[model samples]
Target: MLCGVHNHDLAPNLSGHLLAGRLRGEEKQRVIDMTKSLAKHRNILTDLKEKNKESVTLI
Candidate 1:
């Protein structure tokens, strides 16, 4: 579920990447653990960028 904030309240970075929304409850804990797990490993950053690039091209 989304946080449901008004669109006008949302802001993007200078590069136009929108803010990753705030997380709450048990879902937030899960994301925290998942992030730590990803960080402990290698190549996640590269893999995400590569996947995003491929997705952009496909779009």
Candidate 2:
């Protein structure tokens, strides 16, 4: 299963599984950080696309 910022709704479920597993604290933090980064990047890409569409409409 894929886990990332895009699927935040699944975070609680995933966290439960992770907590039940042997993943270390540091590793878990890394995963959380990575997810946040992915989400930020997705937002940036979405904003850029919207701006591009607006510019295209103006052209």
Instruction: Give the per-residue lDDT of model 1 (tens digit) for 21-59.
Output: 222355346546657776532344344435444321110
In candidate 1, the residue pairs with backbone N, CA or C atoms under 3 Å apart (3 or more residues apart, or in different chains) clash, namely none
User: Each model's TM-score?
Assistant: 0.27, 0.29
How many pairs in model 2 have backbone atoms within 3 A of each other, for residues 3 or more apart or on separate chains, i.e. clashes?
0
Candidate 1 whole-model C-alpha lDDT, 0 to 1:
0.41
Predicted model with the maximum TM-score: 2
Worst 10 residues of 1 by lDDT: 50-59
Runs in model 1 with CA error above 4 Å? 1-22, 39-59
Question: How accurate locally is residue 31 in candidate 1, as Cα lDDT from 0 to 100?
Answer: 45
lDDT of 2 by residue, 1-59 (tens): 25634643545433235444443465446446756777565554454446444221110
